[model samples]
Target chain A: MALPVHASPLERIWHYAYLVICALIFVFLVAPILVVIPLSFNAEPYFTFTDKMLSLDPAGYSLRWYDSLLTFGMLAPDAPRDGAWYADMWRNAAWVKAAKNSIIVGFWATLLATVLGTLAALGLSRPDMPWRRAIMAILISPMIVPIIIIATGMFFFYSNPCSILGFECGRLTSTYTGIVLAHTILGIPFVIITVTATLVGFDQSLNRAAASLGASPRRTFFRITLPLILPGVISGALFAFVTSFDEVVAVLFLAGADQQTIPRQMWNGIREQISPAILAVATILVVISIGLLTTVELLRRRSERLRGMTPR
Target chain B: MADLTAAAPLTTADGRPLKEALARAQRRAKTRAFLLVAPLLLFVIVSFVIPIAQMLHRSVYHDGFSANAPAVSAWFAANPPGTPPDEAAFAALAEDFRAMKAAKTAGEAGTRVNYTLPESRSLFTKTARDADRLAPPYRDAFLAVDPKWADPEVWQAMRSSSSAYTSDFYLSATDFRHTADGGIERVEPRQRIYVYLYIKTFVLSGVITLLCLILAFPVAHLLATLPMAKANLLMILVLLPFWTSLLVRTTSWMVLLQGQGVVNETLLSLGLITDSGRLRLINNQTGTIIVMTHVLLPFMILPLYSVMRVIPPSYVRAARSLGASSWTAFRRVYLPLTLPGIGAGALLVFILAVGYYITPALVGGADGQLFSNMIQFHMSKSNWSLAAALSAMLLAGVLLLYWLYDRLIGIDNLKLG
Candidate 1:
């Protein structure tokens, strides 16, 4: 069918207005992130313009901060002499540890939640499943409940007299395991939600066809169902990874000095000190996030194509 | 259903009835599902439910006063002639105090006193110190030291402490109370807090939701209707923030918004204003709103865009063909179709925003602090019961608002896709 174009004068004006509003909103959404890209190249220590002022000086484009971020670590190489921005950031060892912890925790938690959540989604999506709606709601409660409550409960329950196999559980408070477990709990809902969304478009007959052709259930899932759902699973994993990576409040209660995540580190950095290194880290994260999201979009498209649900 | 059941095997491996076999299989499936979900269920029960129960229990659990002053409670209850034989009460109270002092643990006694008296710290210490020196008329001396101790209310608090229970903290948090003094009183006006913070949280959440909707709607529209390749590109860009750590996103805003940040520098370079005119963006209400909007915008867009994508363009085209102007066409035909998405996105953003702690905690100045900040403070302070109460309040508020939204707009029909 030919595209209809009722471009009356009033319609044209409205279209222009809509475009203008949308462009402005897009800028508003992107401005903060875009601002970082240029500032990372700023020669000045300050978040603002350099001494070159209105003049575009080559000297204004030094990479000292980036250099320091890569080599000097988050801690200062020397003692605090003058209150230089880079030195102040490097002085906080906790910030560095937290960042590292966030990566480690995010990676493992994402892996675990994705695998388990995808499996759970498959099991729950079975036609024979009873109380599916109620079960779905129950599974999603962790996402709905306030983190403070969860954190507080985690603090108490993970501390002295921890339960294990109906016995006294060892103290897990302030431990890496505690933080990861907390993050995994938080991550599961995202995995479940995303995977379930993908599964809704899934053609069960593909699996049934494979099964009837003498393929085992396990083989059918691995060879047929797995490949079809891989994109959704990967996207869900990415989301779970991001969720764990970004988590802060729960980590505050559950993590100790050694277990601090990147967000917790950033929090302490902002609250205790302000420095350029944090900006560098933020820039890096923004880039990584953009990259991961692109992958998610790619995978989502692949999944849609696999299911014949949408055009690629 | 009957045919399907008939097609399946009617007996177990041992040739038991089909019903038995089906029941056994059903039980196995139940077991399997339970096993699959057990870790999460166990985690929630232990980490989410029990601690909250403990906190709720502690809100009413008071053992300090009554347990510590058994003789005092008994004497007060008896109201025996002439201060109830000061020697007997004093000796018994002195012995109990000595044991508490020797243990060097506040134990139940400390909890009891803390429950009744908000400032029980020094009182407990002072009382513990004098326990060893009690000779003869200890009751009189104790009463003399703190005349408020003679009140029936204090004695009743001591008596009630036999069981570990009191709603004092919740009362205090809410700024209302039936005091041990047998008077219904408001918590001291100066000490009263949190309620205002709770209201401020709701207001802040509402504002953020409105801001997100305003900012996300057009972007979502553009994303939904754009050419496929471009739309996919834009959608990825929109979802980019979701992939990053929230801390990183908020911190990026801080770097961009702070006094010396890029925004100020640009304005300075542009000669928009003098040095002092660099926008005061970070650590204020404005900064909090700006950062929160940035962090929450994706949530609003994703849902709205997903819903918008499925809405056929023909409806709006038909409206325009029927002589409706473009704006009228969109408003009359497009907007209603998108309402479900809008409502869903709004609910998601608002619910998430209400519980938001990190962004506000980082960017919000004193004036911008939300109720979650207090909840964090209480949790860190090891005041589990009060923290639980605050969380319970927040959860209730979320549920109530959700119920209201469902009632008003029909949440079941609000689809994100």
Candidate 2:
């Protein structure tokens, strides 16, 4: 790809122009996301950069938005800075409650998706698996199908859980179980994808060798296969967690006021009114995603190295 | 081969034929593999597949008119098409009106009929309120109560809606209406939205996919041609956005594109235009296209880069060495090699954009809205049947593209990094 010295002036100009075009495209890709990181620190109650802020005046920046994230829904905002004040903030802040709900729902959904998806991936990766293509398509369809469709269908189906069985039962809507199940379905494709990919590089003979050495099937799985595939499983679990954390449409349809997750809360905020507090929340989520992305990337590298696909 | 065919089939140690034994072993393996996947398969069927099926079923099935207007339904069943209403038909209608009045289900029956005949729900309720006064001359008495009921179109609508399951919703969804003579015709232009919106959704998605491909091509090419360390450094810029929360990215666009937002401010300060000429970017089609192209650019870039990275630079060089011009080598040698990536990325982006809801909801006000937003609008209005029908249409379109993607580029090759 290096430019040749024997090339003509026209070719040299084209090469430089191509690089400049690429640089602008990269800026287009990254700038909007990075813009919010600084705007979240704006002292004035605006989404744009004030002149002072742009000029790098120290007085133009503040932690007011981050502070508002704590006090917006609390019982008292002017209370003294004490343990009770902190307790009150944690107890009643709307954002705090949303973060809690997001974590709880994400954890259970990730656990369920990872376990079920890992098992299914193992079955699918087996050479003698029956109807693999069709089954894989079915499993991955929750991802391919539009979220709005899934949300609407879940709305009706969850409204009456037992009606499909020709009986009466309680509703799953507005409950933790319903949200978890919906998110799990949404998260399964990622799990299946990542784990199955990891298994592609797996050496199946290890399990056979363990079995041949008088180890039971269960022992072989726990002692050899699980250990080898743990990185993929963890990465899949992280992906599932993030998917649930970021999901909004399903939550909007299924969650009641008491079960509001972060995205749901942010949706209400943006629709009702845009506040700097939302930007604060967005900033924190960006940080979290950065952390999760790093983890997954490192694990990917570790898995590749472990499988001897990369040199040390 | 003839000798082998003549010989007896080879046997295993236990005297079973080898072919039978081998087949049995393979069958057992397949069953075991299937067993491992059965729990998830059943879970998905119950939680995902069944719910979607039920939603689709709701599009064609509503028991409101059939269950509540039993007498009229029975009379219609006894009679055939083109049957003029007689004394018995009027008597049956009066009986059903009385029954519906007793049950307080006039509204439900009216709502079901309202799908095909607008404002007919009020007709049912209005008639049922005066059902107690109707005399034996039921046909004349009904005409006196509501002169509109004398219309043949009313009778046609009622007859069509008498069944528990009908295709009226699908007809209405596609902007066609049932005629007075029992034939289908297009609704008036003023009322036709779904078909137009469907077309708009597909066309807008196509434009966005094309924009994404244009924006992503050079960047992907650069990444593919760069040295490894440099490419990885630039890759972070792409992956960071891919991993960011969708809401976060969408909110950034909102902040950037709003009228008083940064983009306008920057343009205003730069004297690009008068302050009055600030672009109406947000809450319009331009905003939707711009934001979506940004959001989906990564999808195009990743696939293109993955495809391009494996392409040998030697081919293009050899073309140049053999006296082919740079443009000629690129057009003939490189472009064809990248076609698969283009197809995959375009289909993926187009499918996602077609069903996109959140971005359009926030920024795509009235004229910019897609088909999914219309479905949501119906759902919020509690018009479940129309919403279900629209969703079914969207789902069908998406699944077709998905199947196409699977055929052209195997689903197993779908990558995320």
Candidate 3:
């Protein structure tokens, strides 16, 4: 395609203005995160960069914090060799445990929500499904309801021991199962919405073609339908993962001290202590989130391309 | 021809009525679709809908008064045209109070009454002890224990409980109702909360939505119009923060904006001030707005960028070729074309902002707190009814805005994908 030429000086000025504003925003958006990344490497255990660093001194460069984080008394099976450092690390152990809980909760919630949500999307997208719009609206209600309300409801419902199909499960409040279930409830909507969007352009004809070629329904789905929808499934799963990982308010009421997730840990850290180790964790989290999101974006684009819904 | 005709009927088999021999197949397909959706539907109903319904029910739930105090109800039911028949009814109330005070679950009842009328505790206790006495003077003494009871104010409150449901919390949320004294009044001026908070929430959400658009528009434009490779790179950069925990992002803002943090440090180093700037970035309205705008920008950008991506470049080129200045072309043509995106982004950002709790709580001072904070407060205090009432108001507000936006812009037409 031939590129359009610029027309007027006013247009040129407008373009430059647009570019300048965008550049400024990009800096504003990225600056704090970038600042944290380097500060994570600071030899000093404070927010400030040291004088040595200001003067380009090599002594300022130390991986002590990183080493401290990994071997931090929080993770140590025994007390640290250094007593003071061990106490400090032990003080931070709640945060480490919370972060660990966050990973487990995020993974399971994401996996379950994505699988269930994808199935829901497929079922809803089928032309013959009755009350598709109503079903979708119901599925998406969790996304619309305020988190506090959801938290309150979950608190009440799970505080009492409830039985399902004669299987007596005790009160779920303060349990890992409770938090994961709550997180999945929150995560599933995002997966459903995104996957449904992906499914909108999916070709039923391909599945029909496979079926006509004497493929079993299960085999056709696995070989043809699943592959075409893989990108959607991945993106949906990533969205679910991010949603669960970042969730806090619902978990706040549902999770006990033992079940505290990373966000809750960070919440306490911010409220109680102004530790730079949190900055380190924040930087690490930002990196991981960016990586995951980029992959999601790529998957989204690939899904669109695979469905031939948009130009590559 | 015969083979093809037979195959046509075979194809029709796919669409055959379930009433015929295909009943089993139709039932199986229906069962499969239901099975596929049953788990999520079950989860939402059990986890989301039923709990919310129960919360809503709690708002009007006078079980504390009705279920626990059946004697009180019976006394009212037995008392006929008022000869002040009189001492017997008082005796019955006293008996009910004695039972209520002595009951193991009395505390729960007291707590519930405390939410509505905190002073009811002493009344119940006094009535109980007085009613337990076996004398006429005792009955007169009980009546005198709180003269307010004879004034019909207390009687009215008690009588209003004839129905099992009450709208007291909802009325309180709106700040207009009759006091127990039968005085049609507003809540105490100082206790006159919720209305203002609701207004502030709406205004704050509106401000944040506008700010996101202002901040996101240029960036979204650049991302939409840049060279393909560069645009994708910039888009990723824009979305990068979104993948991180919202709590972490909000906290990071707190860290950066604190008095001794990097922003102030950079300013100090630049000789902007002799000391770190005392901007009071955390725990203020400015901080809330700034953090919220940043957090919600991705929501704005994605929709706007998606919408912008679909507008063919040829329209702008053609307008430019027709002697239209770039500003004119954009303002008159391009901007109008991008309205769908703007609408979608605005609706998404506004709705999210209204319901947001953590960002404002972390960054907002007392003056900056939104309605969601009150919702949290009520929930924690075990005032589920009032919490539900407040949430119902919020949900109504959000839905109204959405309805208005849909009416104004046709949200269905603004699909980003």
Candidate 4:
């Protein structure tokens, strides 16, 4: 907005100061992430920049910490760089195993959340859907409720799946099933929200028209509705994937010794030691989030176009 | 119409009554839609809802000692409070302790009582060890084994804990317990922790919310006023933090704020403080506040930005043209319009911050611990009842706020980056 002609000089000074304030906050937001990248490359073990590091000396940087991530939990880290070393890392490096666990948990959790959430969103979008507001609230409660409460609840629920039911189903805690189930619960709300937002602009008349043309409901869904909502579903799936990938609380409560995920590993590392390896991991996560962000952004635009939300 | 339908039997082209055919179609549609959602709904109920409900149930559910020491439990069931420990009560306890000792279940029995009376685990095990040596007039035998058995408070605690249901854990969660005479009483000063943690959680989260609101308002205003391309570019700064792994951001804070880390080192080089005087920032309240503010700031900025982006600038300009000073114009016109965003952002931040676990766990040392940390502590110790009680209170507060948020800004409007 332009300054009024009658504005006081005091107001003008305040305006410039306000701009400075905003700029500083922007730095506050981004500088932490920026600060970690260079430190991860530091040849020194210190978190701060070394004298040579500030002087831009070549010897001040190294990839040794990244090497440590490979050998952090390896059965034999000092071995030569060969098949045995790689195999030891594959089987035993804590971070490597964590990464694998993160993938498996994220994949299954996302698949469950996306499939269930998408179907529910489809139902929720229908005009004739029963108890719409109440059902929506129930589905979305996992997102709103405090995560610690949820984790505590899962801790109990998984302790004895047979506690309430007559039949015995064995314990769910400290198992892949428990962590995956917990992540799936946490991821459902995101999928429901994203998919439902896309579904808001859907035309119901198309379904009726297909029915009038003698198309079965399943065929009509696959041929028309699924195609139209594919972008939304994909984005929703990605959202679910990210939610599961970034999750740590449930994993903390439910995952067993071998089920440690990356976040859990990072939690241990950050707590026990602030190694440059953690920074290396943080750098990779930052990069992964950037990719996820870009993909979600693109899919959002496509979904908007499919729903005719934006003019051509 | 009724007479006509009766006479003509109103039918569709398919030769069925119109109402019946339409009703059948509607029922089929409803069932089909319901069938699609049924699997997930059932899954959520089984996995999420029931767990939460059961956890709350566990808060008031105390069957540990009752289930373990059935004879003593039956004595309490047979005789109410104020009933002196005659032969039957003492004999029942003696028999139960003997069985527990023989079965090696005295530890569980002790743990159950220890929850009510701290440092009393050894008492159970000790009494169980001496149970066989006791003669008749068993009260003296019990008293000779341990003076704690002579205290009516122990009996009161036992009587209350004997039942399957008791409010002792909830009372303990709120920093209260049963007295000798069966009246609820304040716990000792040394024993009071949960209340302090709750207070600290609320106060710090309140401060964080207020800080976020003050900091985020101007940035959101600038973004809303700027050109689309510039605003979107600037928005990335906010969105990037939102998308980043929470641990990464927390790690960055740890790196910057730890002793001898970036901030302290820089200050040290600048002679701001000596090596010994480098700020104790990490693993304390300061670290928790700084990092949480950094992490949750995006949540505050997003809602404020979304709401601010819609308000026409003309209103403020029009107020300015009416001879209102800039401060007066903003206060009277601009601030009021953004109140919805302010409320939403504050509540959202507060709700999330209050339940915070990972950041506080990583950075918050002793003085900065929250209620959730206490829950985690008890959970790991297998103190399920106490953890459940704490969780019940937390879940209640969060649910209330959630309902408010849903009512004020429909859940459908909940947006993620």
**Best candidate according to DockQ:** 2
Alpha carbon lDDT of each predicted model: 0.72, 0.91, 0.75, 0.87
TM-score of each: 0.86, 0.97, 0.88, 0.95
Judging by lDDT against the true structure, name the best candidate: 2
lDDT, candidate 1, B1-417, per-residue tens: 899877876666788887877888897877665555556555556655565566555556655665665655566566632242346655666667777788765445755555555555566567777666666576676765566555655544454444445666676678775565455588777767878788888898999999999989888888888888888777656766666667777767888787877778778878996797778888888988889988889889988988898999889878977989666987889999999789888988898788877888889987777777888888767666677667778878876765655555543233222
C-alpha lDDT (0 to 100) for residue A72 of candidate 4: 91
Candidate that beats the other on DockQ, 2 or 3, i.e. the better one = 2
Go through the candidates in order and give each one's DockQ.
0.43, 0.77, 0.48, 0.69
Q: Weakest 10 consecutive residues, lDDT, candidate 1 chain A?
A: A1-10
Chain A TM-scores in order: 0.86, 0.97, 0.85, 0.93
User: Which ranges in model 2 have alpha carbons more than 4 Å from their true place?
Assistant: B1-9
Candidate 4 chain A: 10-residue stretch with minimal lDDT: A303-312
Per-residue C-alpha lDDT of model 4 across residues A1-312, encoded as one tens digit per residue: 456667679988888899999999999999998898999999999899999999999899999888889999888899898998899999999999999999999999999999999999999888777777888889998887888889988887897888877676789998998999999999999899888888888888988899899999889999989888888888888878888888889988888898999999998888786789999999888989888878877777777777877532
The alpha-carbon deviation from the true structure for residue B323 of candidate 1, after best TM-score superposition, in angstroms, is 3.7
Query: Would you list the rank order by lDDT, best first?
Result: 2, 4, 3, 1
* Candidate 3 per-residue C-alpha lDDT over B121-155 given as tens digits, one digit per residue, 9 for 90 to 100: 56665555554453555456665776756755455
**Between candidates 3 and 4, the TM-score winner:** 4
Q: Tens digit of lDDT per residue, candidate 1, span A131-155?
A: 6655665566667666766777677
Residue-wise C-alpha lDDT for candidate 4, range B43-128, written one tens digit per residue: 99999999999899988987778988999899888887788777789888888887887888888877777888888889888887
Report the Cα lDDT for residue A207, model 2.
85
